[model samples]
Target: MYVATKGGERAIEAAHQWLAEERRGDRDVPELSIAQIREQMSLAVNRVMAEGSLYDPDLAALAIKQARGDLIEAIFLIRAYRTTLPRFGASLPVETGEMAITRRVSATFKDVPGGQVLGPTFDYTHRLLDFKLAAEGTTPEAQRKSADETPAPHILDLLDRDGLMEPLETSEDTPSDLTREPLEMPADRPLRLQALARGDEGFVLSLAYSTQRGYGRTHAFVGELRIGTCAVEMEIPELGFAVEIGEVELSECETVNQFTGSKTEPAQFTRGYGLVFGQNERKSISMSLVDRALRWEELGEDNTGAPAQDAEFVLYHCDNIQATGFLEHIKLPHYVDFQSELELIRRLRREAGAEEREAAE
Candidate 1:
C-alpha cells in the first residue's frame, strides 16, 4: 500500500502558477505562435504525434508550446487529450504504392523504376550551423515540377516477382487495438508493430543499433525507403463504398534480411517493415531493424538472448509515457515505505550486535 500526504493544495497551486509564468518566459519577447511551431518545428510535432498516437498537427503544436518545447511532456499532453476524444470508424489500410512520392531511395538497387528523388534531406549537408538562419535569412524557392502520374512501385515487388523474398501472408483478421486491449505475452505481429510504431525513438534506435553491432545481427539491407502523402479512405456503411477521408505523410522502410530456409522450404530473403508518421526516416529504419529482430521466433531463428529479441522487455519498457510516469513518481512522498525499510534494517543490525555480545560474554 502507498501512503498519501495531504495539505499541499496551496503550495501545489502556487507552483503551477509559477510554472505557467516560466512557460510564458520574458514578456518582452514575442510568443511563439502555433502555426510557427507547426511549420518550422515540424519534426518535433511529428515525434509528438507518433508517440502520442494522435495525428492532429495543430493539437501537437499546441502541446509542444504548452510543454515549453519538451517533446516528452508534449507527448504526454497530447496523449491525455487523445483519451478524451471519441473514436470514429477506422480507415481502410493505406495504399502506399499509390503514394504521391516526395522522397524515395533504395540501397538494394542503384536504379529503381521511379529513380531516386532526393527531396529535402540533410544527408549531404555539412554539420556546420548556418549563421544566415540566425540573421533571419530567406532561402530562394525550390524549382517546381509537374506531378508524375505513374505510381512508384514497391521495391519488394521486384524481389517478390523472382521469388527471392518471402511472400507476405494476407490476413482478414482485424488487428487488436493496443490502446484498448491489455498487452498479452506472445503478442501477434500486428500488436508488436503497433507497439513499435509508438515506442520511444531513442530506445528503439538503441535496440536497432545493438542488432547492427552483432548482438542479434540480421544481415539487413534497406530494400526501400520512401516518404510521401497517402490518401486515407473510410467506408461509410450507408454509401456502401469507401470515400477519401484525408492524407497523412508517412515514412516507410522495408529491409531485406539474409535468406532463411529449411529443407522443406525454399531459401527466401526475410523482410522487415516499418511505417511511421511524417518524414521520420531514422525512426522508420530503426523500427524496421527492431521489428526484424523481434521476429526471430516466427522466422524459426534461435533466440540470441538479445534485448531486441525479448518481446516482454521491448514491449514493457518501450513506452516513454509509462516509463516517465513510474520514474517521476519517485519524487512523491514515500515516507511510510522508507520508514519501514529503515526500521527493518536497524532491527537486523541490533539483533546482530546482540548476538555478537552474547557470544563474547
Candidate 2:
C-alpha cells in the first residue's frame, strides 16, 4: 500500500505565505491600490457584496484584490469576514419609496414622476473592447445627474388608485433573516428575498429569462428600478419607538404583471417586488420576475411545474456561492470514496463477465 504523504502544519503555513505573496503579485509591478479597486473594479466588488450579504464596498474591493479578482474566492473572503462580525439587532424596514435617489429608471414609462434619471449605467454604451483600460488610461467617468426634489408615488400605486391593480397589504409581521437561521423549507417572503439577494446573478437572470419564454409566463414590465440609500430604523424597546440605526444603499425593483382574476374576483394588475443590497439593478429586476413566478400558488394559477415556478428549484439553485462551493469541492481529495466505487464496479463487471460466459456456453 502506498502511504499518503503528510506535512500538514508546515505545508499549511507555506501555503498561507505563498498565497500572501501571490495576492501581492510582483513587487516591482506596484500593487493595485484598494481605492483603485473600489473605484475601478467596482462591478466585481458589487458581486461580492451581493453574494456575501455584506454591503461594504471598500472591504469587498480589498477582498477582491486579496482573492486575485476571482469572484468566488472574494465571496468566500466576505463570508468569512461576515462570520466574525457581531450580530446587531434587526433594523426596521426602510420605506424604499423614500430612498434618496441615485439611479432610477423605468423602461415602461416614457416620462414618469422623478423623471427617469439613468444615473451611472452602461445601458446605451456600445459593446466594444476599450484598449485604454488594459493600460489604465483616461476613460470618462459615467455622468451623474442631480435627482429631482420631489418623487411621485410608485407607478403601480397609480394603477391601484384607479382600481386596476392589487394594493399591498400593510403587514406588521417581522421578516425573517436567512443569514442567521438555517434555511427552512416552505420559506416566507422575507426568507425568499434574502436568498434571492445573495443568489447567483447568472442563475437568477436565466430563471427570469425563462419566464419570458413562456415557462410559467407572466406579462411583466419594469415598473421601477431604483438605487439609493434608505434610513434603516430600529425599534428601541426601551424607547417605545423605532429610531434610525443606520442607512444602507439598496437596489429595489417593482414589476407590474398582468393579473388573472378568479370567478368571484375582479381583474387587477398583480405585481412582483425585489429589494437587494447595493446598486444591482439587473439582479433586482431578475429577482422581481423570479419572485412573481414563485407566487403562482398564491395567485391561484395552475402550477405548470416549471423550474422557475418551483420555489424549491429557484431558491435552491439561485446562490452561486453555495452551488459553486459544493460543486467544486468535489475536486478536492475524494480518493477514498473513488477507490471504493472503483472496487465495487470492478467486482460487479467481473461477476457479470463470468455469468455471461456461463450463459453463452
Candidate 3:
C-alpha cells in the first residue's frame, strides 16, 4: 500500500500560471476585445444570460472573456456576480403581446394574420463554407423592407378565441426563484418552468427530443415562435403607477398539444409555453416540449416512464454548474482510498497463490 503525496501548493500555482499562458495562446496576435465577443459571439452571451438568469450582455461578455470562452464557466461567473448586486425591486411581468417582434413563425398555419416574418435566420442557408470569410471579406446585406410598426398578435390567440386550446388563467402569485431556495420534489408548473428556463440547454434539448421520439409523445405543433424586445415595467407604490424599467430581448414559444378529453370533459388542445432570455428558438421549443411532458399527471395522462416526465430527475441534474462541480471533483486527491483498495487486491492475490501451491503439494 502506498501513501498519498505531500503538499503541492507551489506546483498548483505553477500549473495555474501555465494555464493562464495557454489561455492567452500566441502573444503576437491581438487579444480579443469584449465588444467583439459581445457582437460576434452574441449567441454565447445570450446562453450565459439565459442560464445565469441575468440579462446583461456586457457582463456576460466580460464573463465569457474571463472564463476563456467556456460558456458554462461564464454562466457561473455571471450567476456569482448577480448575487452580489443589490435588489432594487421586482419588475412587473413583461407583456409579450406588446413585444416589438423581430422574428415570428408558426408551423400550424403558414399564413396567419401578421404573416411569417423570417428575420435573420439560418433556416434557408445552404450551409456552404465561404473561403472569403477567412480573409475578412464582407458579404452585401440582403434587401429589406421597413418593419411593420404595429405589434404582431400571437397566432395561438386565434385558437384560444375559438375555445380550441386549453384555457390559460392569469395569476398574480409571485414565482419562487430556484436560486434563492432549495429545490424540492413535486414542483409546481411555475417552478418546473423556472428550472427548465435556466437548465442546461443541451440537456433539456435531449430530454425534449426523447419525448418526441415516442418516449412520452405529446404530439406538439408549433403554434407560434417569437423573438422580440419587450418593455419591463415596475409598479411604483409612491408613484401610484407602473413605469417602464427597461427593455429585454426574449424568445417565446407556444406549442399546441393533443389532449383527448377524459370521461368528465370534452377533447381540446392543450398549451405548452416557453420563454427565454434571447433569440433562442431551439431552447424555447425544447423547453415547451419538456414542460408539456411533465404536465402528464395534471392532464390526466398515464405516466410513460420517460426521463423528461420525471420532474425530480430533470430538475436535480439540470444545472451544469452543479453537475460539473460533482464531475470534476472526481479528479481531486483520492490516493488514500485507492491505496486501501490496492492493498486489499495484493493481499487477495497472495492468498490465492498460497492456496494454489498447497493444493498442488
Candidate 4:
C-alpha cells in the first residue's frame, strides 16, 4: 500500500519547474525547431514513432525536445499523448511487394529480378567521424536516378515458384490489436509480431544475437531486405472501396530458415518476416531473427530453453515503457514502506532479546 506524503506538493512543483528550465538549457544558443529534428534526426524520430506506436513525426520531434533528447522518455510522452487521441479506423495492410524501389538487396541470390539498388546506405562508409559536419551550412548532394515504373518482385515469390520455400497461409480473420487487448499467453503469430514491431530495439537485437550464437539457432539467412515507401490505404464506410491515405517509409526483412522434413510435412525452407516503420535495417533484421526463434513450437523444432524461444518471457519484457515504469518506480517515495520493514525487524529483535533475558533469569 502506498501512503500519500504530507507537505511535499510544493517541492514536487518546484522540481518540475526546474526540470522544464533544464530541458531548455543555454538560452543563448539557437533553439531547435521541430522541422530541424524531423529532417535531421530522422532515425531518432523513426525510433520514437516505432516504439511509441505513433506515426506523427511532428509530435515525435516535439516529444523528443520536451524530453531533452531522452528517447525512452520521448516514447513515454508520445504514448501518453497517444492514449488521449480518439481511435480512428484501422488502415488496410500496406503491401510491401509494391513498395517504390529505394534500397533493395538479396543475400541468397546474386542478381534478383530487379537489380540491387543501393539507396542512401552507410554499408560502405568508413567508421571515421567527419568533423566537417560540425561546421554550419554544408549542403550534400546525391546522384539522381529515374524512378522505375515497374514494381520490384519479392524474392520470396521467386523461391515460391520453385516450391523450395514454405507457402504462406492466407487468413481472412481480423488480427487482434495488442494495443487494445491484454497480452494473453500462447500468443498467435500476428499478436507476437505486433509486440515485436514496437518492442525495444536493443532487447530484440540482443535476443536475436543469442539465437545466432547457437541458442535456439535456426540457421537463418537473409532472403531479402528492402527499404522503401509504401502507400497506406483506408476503407471508407460510405464508399465500399479503399482509398489511398498516405505513404509511410518502411524497412522489411525476410529470413529464409533451414527446415528438415518432418513426418507430416515435406522438406522446405521456412520463413521469418519483419516489417517496421522507417529505414531501420538493424531493428528489422533483429526482429526477424527473434520472430523465427519464437516459432520453435509451430515449426516442429525443439525448444532449446532460450529466452527468445519463450513467448511469455519475450512478450512480458519487450515493452520498454512497461519495463522503464517498473524499474524507475523504485526511486519513488518508499519511506513509509521502508519504515514498516524497519519496525518489523526491530520488533523481532526485541522479542528475541526478551526470550534470552527470561532464560537467563
Candidate 5:
C-alpha cells in the first residue's frame, strides 16, 4: 500500500522517472523546450511564480515541464530550488509607487488623475473555450505594445488629497522577508499582507468569500489594481549608492473597506492590501480582503469570532505549499501508530477471553 511504503527515496525516484516518460509520451515526438513552455504554458508558469514567490520564468517553465504540467508541483520545485540558492544580500524595497504602470484601475473612483488602463486582462472575455488553440498549428497575434515613458499616478493619493479615506504614510523601516523568516503571530500590516499575497489562492479566496457572506463583512471596493515591472535595486557596500539588479512583474491591489470607529475615534475608512510576485490579480484582491478582515482587533472592534477575524486561523491555513505537503504526505507510511493500535486491540481481545473463562469458572 502507498501508506505502508518504507523506501520514500526509491519511490520518489521511480515515480519521477515514470512521470518523465509520461511527459514525453512518444519518444519519436519532439520534446518541449523551456522557451515553448514559457511562451505557451505561460499561465501555469505565472501561477507557480506567484505562489512560489520567485519570478524566473525559465525556471518556472522547466519546473512545470518536469512536474508534467502540475502547477503546485512546479511551485514546490521553485520553492525547493530557492531554498538552496545562496542569499547574496537584501535588495531595497521595490518602489511600486514609482512603478512604470502598464495597467492602473480603481473601482472606487471615477474621472481620476491618470485614467484607468485595463491593460491585459481576461475579465471582459467570454467563458467559451477556445477550440482554435487545439488546431494543428496556430499563430494568433504578433501584436505587442511597448510601454509608454510617462510617469503614473495612484488613484488613492487623489482620494488622500480629498481626505475621504485614511491616508497611509510611507515608512523608512526595513520590512521582514516572509520567505527567509518564520511568521510570528500578531504580525504587522506589511508582514501579514506579504504572507497572504504568496499564500494559497483558493484558501485566500474562500476566506475572502466568507467575509463577503456576512461572516466578517466589511463593505469592500477595489481601490486600485496595478500590474507592471518594477526595478529591484540593491545598495552596494563599496558603492554606497544602490544599483539596479533587475525588474520583476508584480500585481498590487489596494482595497478601501468599510469604516470602523467609535465616538472617541474619528470614523476613518480602512485599507486591505495584497502584493504578489507575478501577475495574479485575483490572489492579490482576495489577499486584501482577508487582510482587512484580520484587522478587527487593532481597529478596536470586538472579535465577531469570524474565520477571517481569527489571526491564528488565517495565517496558519493560507500557505499552499504547507497545506499540500501535509495533506499529500498522508499517502506515505503511517503504520507505526497503526501498529500500536493493532497491538492494543489484540491485547484487549486476549484480556476479554481470560475474563470470560474466569466468569464461567
Candidate 6:
C-alpha cells in the first residue's frame, strides 16, 4: 500500500523561486558584485577554493555569490563545475623550498633561519570587536619591509643534519587521487592526507583537539608553519624540460611528534606534514596533527582506539557533502515505512492480548 508522493517537481520549482527572491532581499539595496566579493570576501573565497580542490579565486567568488554566500554550497558548485573540465596533463609536484615566504613560524625554536616573520596573522590580535569598522572608512596601509632574497631552509632539514629527526624518503611513485579512484580501507598516508586536505575544516579541527585532550596523545610541536606562493612546473614533452606554468598560494605545516624507537634503533623525532591550497593555516595545522595521530601504527605505537587514530573512521566521515546529504535526507517522506512499522506493532499487541486472555480462562 505504498504510493509515490506527487507534486515534487512543482514544489521544487516553487522552492527555488522563493530562494531566488530571498537571495535578493530588498531590491532597493545594492546588489553585491562578483569583483566586490572577490576582493572583500576573499577569505570566504579562499575557503571555497581550498575545500573544493580548485584554485580559481574568480570562479569561487562567483560560486559564493550564486549560492547566496553559502560556503558549502559554493564548494559544491565549484566541485561540480570542476568535474566537467578536461584535464590535459598532471603538473609536477610543487617545490616548497623555492616558496616566496610570506608568513613563517616555528614553535620548536624561537630563533630560526627565517627570523619568524609573522605576516598577516591574527595570532596577536585582541578578540574584541573593532567598532571603528562599523563606520564607512578605508584601512590605512602599514609600513612595509624589503623582501628577503634568500630562501629559508626548512627547520627539519637542520635537525636532519644531526639525525635528530626521522629521515623522509623521496619517491617517484604517483599518489592516488581520491576523486578519480575509490577510497579503500587501511589507506596509506598519502591517501589520508588527500582526504584530509579537502575535509571539513571544523571537523578536522575538533578531531585534532580531541587528540590533545588525551584521546590519542601525540606530543606534537609546531616544527614550522609557512604560507607563501610557489611556482607550478609542468614537464614539456617537446622541450624535454619542466617549465613553470603558473604559481599558487600555498599553506604548509610540519609537526614534530614524539618518537617510538625499537631496541635496535635510536629514538628520533617523527614528523607529520600538511599542505593545502590557499592560506588556510588553521586547516593545515589541524591536518598535520590528525596526520600524525593516524601514523601511530606505522611508527610502532599502540592504537589507543582514539577517533582521530582510526584511519577508516576519520576518512569515511570527514566529507561535509556526504555527511550533509545523508543527514538532510531524513526530511523526505517515510509515511509508507512508518505505516508498516505501525502495523507490525499492532499485530504483536493483539497476539499478546489474546494469549493473556487464554491464560486467564
Q: Using TM-score as the measure, which candidate wins?
A: 1
Q: Give the higher-TM-score candidate: 2 or 4.
A: 4
Error of 6 at 203 (Å): 1.0
**Model with the higher TM-score, candidate 3 or 4:** 4
Candidate 1 runs further than 4 Å off: 1-7, 144-149
Tens-digit lDDT track of model 2 for 171-248:
788777777777878987778888988988889999899999998756799988888888888898899999886777
Global Cα lDDT for candidate 4: 0.90
Candidates' C-alpha lDDT: 0.90, 0.83, 0.89, 0.90, 0.83, 0.89
lDDT tens digits, residues 1-361, model 4? 4667776989889999999999888999988999999999999999999888888999999999999999999999999998899987999989888888678888999888988888878889998988887786667776867545468889988889999998996899999988778899889999999999999999999999998998885689899999888899999999999999898888999999988867788889989889888878899999999998998888778888999999999999999999999999999888888988999999999999999999999
- Who is ahead in lDDT, 1 or 3? 1
Q: How well does model 3 score by local distance difference test?
A: 0.89
Each model's TM-score, in the order given?
A: 0.96, 0.92, 0.93, 0.94, 0.90, 0.95
State model 2's lDDT.
0.83
Model 6 misplaced regions, further than 4 Å: 4-6, 145-149
Model 5, residue 22: C-alpha shift (Å): 1.5
**What does the lDDT read for residue 60 in candidate 1?**
95
lDDT of 5 by residue, 1-361 (tens): 1255579789899988887789888989889899999987776788899888888999999999888888888889999999988888988888887777777788987776667777877889998988877785666673656554456676777767777677684899988889999999888878887788778888999999999998885679999999888999999999979999999888899999867576665777778888887778888889989988988877788788899988888888888889899999988667787788888999999999999999999
* C-alpha root-mean-square deviation, each candidate: 1.8, 2.3, 2.2, 2.0, 2.9, 1.7
Instruction: Give lDDT tens digits, candidate 3, residues 1-361.
Output: 4454566788889989997898788999999888999998888898999999999999999999988999999999998998899888888889888888788899999989888889878899899997888998787887866545568888988998998888885678887878789788889999999999999999999998998899885789999999888999999999999999889999999999998987765799998889999888899999999999999888888898999888999999988888988999889988778888989999999999999999999
Q: Between which residue pairs do clashes occur in model 4?
A: none
Cα TM-score of candidate 1: 0.96
Candidate 2 global TM-score: 0.92
**Best first by lDDT, ranked:** 1, 4, 3, 6, 5, 2
